[model samples]
Target: MASRRRSLATYAVATLVLPLALAACGQGGDEVDVDVTGTAPATPAGSSPASPSAGGSSGPGAPPSGRTELPTSKRPTVVGTVVTGLEAPWGLDFLPDGDAIVTERDTTRVLRVTADGEVTELGTIDAAAPEGEAGLLGVAVSPGFADDGLVYLYVSTAEDNRVVRAELRGDRLGATEDVLTGIPNGFIHDGGRMVFGPDGHLYVSTGETGEPERAQDREDLGGKILRITTDGDPAPGNPFDSPVWSWGHRNVQGLAFDGEGRLWASEFGDSTWDELNLIEAGANYGWPEVEGRDEGTIEGGPSGDYVDPQAQWRTDEASPSGLAYADGHLYLAALRGERLWRVPVGPDGAGEPEEFLVGDHGRMRTVAFAPDGRLWLTTSNRDGRGTPAEGDDRILVLKP
Candidate 1:
């Protein structure tokens, strides 16, 4: 597929720059809010606009009220590479001191990379059974890492998909403890992205493991966004009285929190549309019932039975995976589309989305904003999906 880059528009520093920080929710108390001063691009011509009712509440699952516009910034540029020669790098989160903890999906290797691009293998997660899309996927440092020294991991085992944590004792990991368990696992669709919300609760995304019916089953752990404490207990105000915060999703891989702390997710569609959804508490996404908009297409939108996606794209254009919110925009890493999408958002709604770094890196996977005000992106060519470049898989740094 041919890639396209949108033309950017310059905005004044005083108006465009706002207090935004890195994308990680696991920064603990060291979360630094910085202004990424620059210009933002206009949506390229011929691009589709976002849903008209993006900020308005349609019903149960609509975006909540009291939303506001975020500070906009300039387009991101690649400054340097943090590391290279990585095999399917997946989860990425930074420690308080700015070093990153990275996870490898198939190799089950956990690594700590310094800010200057020095890579060190911390340990291997022996419990993960790597097959297909399942393995050691998401890694997060504890919100209280300075005091607790704990780091959490989301791994796929033979029995089930689970989250485990261990102490980061310098160069090695201590014994692991199960934080949460019993999520449905499969050769495909084992959703394994995790992030800590500003509320200090862990938010986990789970796929239905290719079973469409499992998405609607409340008792089933699959196809849901779960909120839990660090100890694995359900958070206090969960709508289902269980760990489930939202349900009825078809393979959600990307999760990020906007400046207003609203949760947003990127979902893979079934041969139709890929979605960028504004998630709400207890809302149903109409996985098997709906794919994108309520345009009455075949297997398209439901009749007010499910929430609509904020924006959508053709499947070939955007098999979106990792998502990050930085500088008042949502950055989506696309696999099949092979581009980074920058969608401008506000309390009113989403604007036209522009394409960035298109086809320059193959099969973008994880896109995280580092504490030092740059973007960290990983490639997934070695995951048996895309054509591998010389590096096959690498971690590149971008300035946004």
Candidate 2:
């Protein structure tokens, strides 16, 4: 039972209730204000191929009611193959044995889903993970897994949500140690995504516990990506004096490093905007201050600085979730969009985010590249959405 910081009082609660969402709305005019949080006005989808900046409405939303039959477009259909049977998997990672571990959000368990489609129940964490948006979320393997036997996980517990490290034995997880704790613990804003950066340090994406204002708070871990060492201390040379690597995000769900070792993050925006941002050290992404580039103007006021998203969606195309960089492209999993986006990358961030496998599958949650050079993706169908097939929860492999 750990206590939150004194600063996380009101703003943290704001992120939990729906009202705080209004703060994410980017302010109009120039020079965005730091404290003003407002809702982003509803806008149509923008910038498709040809002229990406061009705007349009979101494609068909989730099925009208039960078992909504999705339309199939004649676009490039990415054939999906079942690589393994899994639970409601949130994050996927690979082990040295070529086996992969998948975290089940609601069931409070982890599975070693092998490439052969066999699932080995790897015990369960009976602590706590409230439904709505919380549960056992992102996971990352240690760089020294071969020697350390350590596995890191971001979980939402009844007491609080934070990052924990443990050892992986045969079928059970060994002693669990808390690396980082006391992040706001709402059903949302747990900011449950984690990844090992190129520098071998852990880079974590934490939601503002629904408190949009905390996204802009330098002293808080909410709505920010934190860089920490294996022992849970802030990595040396961090942009701020704290564990924060980047801040001012609504809910950062996805994290991936490009071929050049540049980090990219995908976020779940408010009703209007969902985003894909290139994460940089000591950068502030507009959250309560600004939503996207349109509202991040300098004239709006707060000169605290802001980072623009590489690409954004009309809220429909991108309940942007887990992301993985592979095949010279950045693959992002869309939870609300029910699609996978392939964002081409250059020296900067993204060039064009092409919608692949549109409506071909259900909601995509996590995407990871296997050592075999194939893409492994997880679906979120079981989480309060469309009907799950006989094998409701599953892990699929995609190969070009």
- Best candidate (score: TM-score): 1
Q: Point out where model 1 deviates above 4 Å.
A: 1-73, 296-304
Report the C-alpha lDDT of model 1 over 1-400, residue by residue, as the tens digit: 1111111122121011110101111100111222211122222222211211122222223332343333233446666666777777889999998888999888888998876667778899999998878889998899999999999999999999999999999989898899999999988787788888888988888888879788878889998888899999999888779998878787788888878677788888777667777776777777777666653333333323566677776666578888889768888888887777777877654566666666778788899988977888888887777666665577877766
The Cα local distance difference test for each model comes to: 0.72, 0.65
Per-residue lDDT of candidate 2, residues 1-400 (tens digit): 1111111112211111010121122101111112211122112222121111112122223121222222333222333444433445787889988888788777767777666566677777776554667888888989899999889988888877889988998878886789999877776656677888778988888888778788878888888888899999999877787898877778888888776667778887777667677665666676765554443145453335565566667676667788888757877777667677766676544565566656556777889888877777777667655445555455666652
Q: Give the count of colliding residue pairs in each prediction.
A: 2, 24
Lowest-lDDT window of 10 residues in candidate 1? 13-22
Badly placed stretches (over 4 Å) of model 2 are 1-80, 83-85, 295-303
Please state every model's RMSD to the true fold in angstroms: 11.7, 12.7
TM-score to native of every candidate shown: 0.81, 0.80
Best lDDT among the predictions, by candidate number: 1
